[model samples]
Target: MKTTSYISRQVENLKPSGIRRFFDLAAQMDDVISLGVGEPDFVTPWNFIEQSFHALEQGYTSYTENAGMIELREEISNYLSGSFQLDYDPNEQLVVTVGASQAIDLALRTVVEPGDEVIVVEPSFVAYVPIVSLAGGTPVTIQTKAEDDFKLKPEQVKEAITPKTKAIMLCNPNNPTGTFLNKEELQQLAKVIEKNDLLVLSDEIYAELTYDDNYTSFPSIEKMKERTILISGFSKAFAMTGWRLGYAAGPADIIAAMVKIHQYTMMCAPTMAQHAALEAMKNGRQSVQEMTESYKQRRNFIVSSLNEIGLSCPNPGGAFYAFPSIKETGLSSAEFAEQLLQEEQVAVVPGEVFGSGGEGYVRCSYATSIKQLDEAMERMKRFVEKRL
Candidate 1:
């Protein structure tokens, strides 16, 4: 049997992740500076590491309960309540997964039936559209505009809804653009969601990284608890990306269904990771605050520097990314990214990979140290000046 012929058409047709390719390229180079991958550059918090080690020493190396250990789930429930004023029952509403990535996939697979249409906001995380497709659903995109701060509009959401529409996936403190839906913005969308009787899959992995104001959890809104599935994890704020742990909280029935798929496919998230997460929930707030402060500083510097150098970048309200328009340079996002990598040894992700609305922009992650960022900025400035 031919290897290529044996692969399913769906698998064959899927394009590799744009972020992964640039990250891989940077890895192969000696002096390249990357603002490509969305992960935090910080190591996992020391307390988390200490607890994980303690857990290993105690022989806590088995799989947890299918839904996750009771203690960890309770900690997650309490953390959500204390952090965002959102309430959930650990036994009925939460399931710990391998990571936020797995939580997303499990959510889609649980709700999306063959041919269902799922509304996905564009300039979003790359995984949403593909995950919907893999779950046998149609992805209908709502392309947010750069001028609008890349925030999804209520009217746009209303217009995209169809008779076949089943759900909408939201990435708050959105990736690529680093845009967030403030309370009023969420209220506007809430009206549309309630009017259409639709469900929401809220990805709040970067919830702790919001700047300018406190972040409001979608499920915290009035009457939204039943309609919203909230996904969050320790990867971003706690700098624990490699730990591969995350959890989903939502309506009991929906979460239960997701747990079924998770039970068969994943069995459970790692027990040791869950132990560390429990400790994080209890004592990691200070570590999260410190990391967020660092990212905010980097954000301010990078955004200011980019604008000073001629690129127009919106002030991202949350997350550690700045999406800058490269339209003025008359180069496509992909072209600009390619030229920057080749010419200045700076690596950035082309915005178009986030979908069509991203065509004229590129995403710059400010999660690196200020020294690296300063060097990257100098190189990027040089690249822009030469073009101008």
Candidate 2:
């Protein structure tokens, strides 16, 4: 008997994430120093972890509401309001998710229909394109320029619009580039979104880690709030990536649709994680501040060190990653990463994994300790001198 080939067309056509490929290679090598993954190197605050155990001791391990525990939603609502001055009714406009990853997936699934176009700014987190495609939307990438610090320009957004365009995905305080969208920048893009009446999915996982001015939220734009789905989580800011807890806030109709999808897809986010996140939100500002400061120091160190070695990397204004141009080395981003890993045992991500705008650069995350960073810098210096 012969077995028939079986797989969904969507699953068959999907490409694995480029970042994951490099991570797998790095993981198998001994003495390799990785500055690849975007997660914070800090541990979750003691208070939050203790609260999770306390909840378990109290037998609060059952399933939560599909949206999440009401108390957690309330805490998130208050946190957003107090922190970003964005108003969201917890009861009507929020749904807890496994992570910002799941929230992004659910938001696209809820809003995009087959063949609809979803505009993604390039040099973004790798998850957006596949997630949009899995949700049956076409992923249309809009390349942002380094001269603009990788910020999305209004003209670019306007040019990407089409009758079939259903939504625009904004990754402010962006991952690979560490570029942030300010109020003025957001307002300019908002005008195009409002004019086209398109939906916005704002992934703000690194909002609290900004080094420059205060981070702006999409909901803060009065015109765009009604159609925007704001996705954030405790992962990056609270160092709770393993906890898999996040939430989305938006208009009632949008949130309701996402909740329905969440109900069928995941039922609910982890109960203990939700409980722990509530505690974090109520009392984790200081932990966030400490981590942000540490990242700032690392950021300054790495940017300066890279420049000293003849690689020009602009000072990142937000997030913990620094994207440095590798043009002088005469290698593509992938070749440079591979050669550095083999020669110096230092691992960094190739920027092209993030999309077209990242070709001549590589992403170096500053989330590691100063000791590790110093060592990595030395290795990087040797590698650059040898190559250049």
Lowest lDDT 10-residue stretch of candidate 2: 1-10
Q: Over 4 Å off in model 1, which ranges?
A: none
lDDT of 1 by residue, 1-388 (tens): 6699988998788888777776676777778898996899988888888998999999999888999999989999889988899889999999999999999999999999998999999999999998999999999999999778899999999899999999999989999899988999998899999999999999999999998888999989889889999998989998889889999999999999999999999899988888889889989989889989999999999999999999999899999999999988899998899889988999999999999999999999999999999999999999999887
| TM-score on alpha carbons, each prediction | 0.98, 0.98
Clashing residue pairs for model 1: none
lDDT to native, each model: 0.92, 0.92
RMSD of each: 1.0, 1.1
State the lDDT at 310 in candidate 2.
91
Name the runs in model 2 displaced over 4 angstroms.
1-4
lDDT of 2 by residue, 1-388 (tens): 5433476788879998888888888888999888986898998999999999999999998999999999999999999999999899999999999999999999999988998999999999999999999999999999999898888899999899999999999988998999988889898888889999999999999999898797789889877788899999999989999999999999999899999999998999998899789889999989999998999999999999999999999988898999999999999999999889988999999999999899999999999999999999999999999877
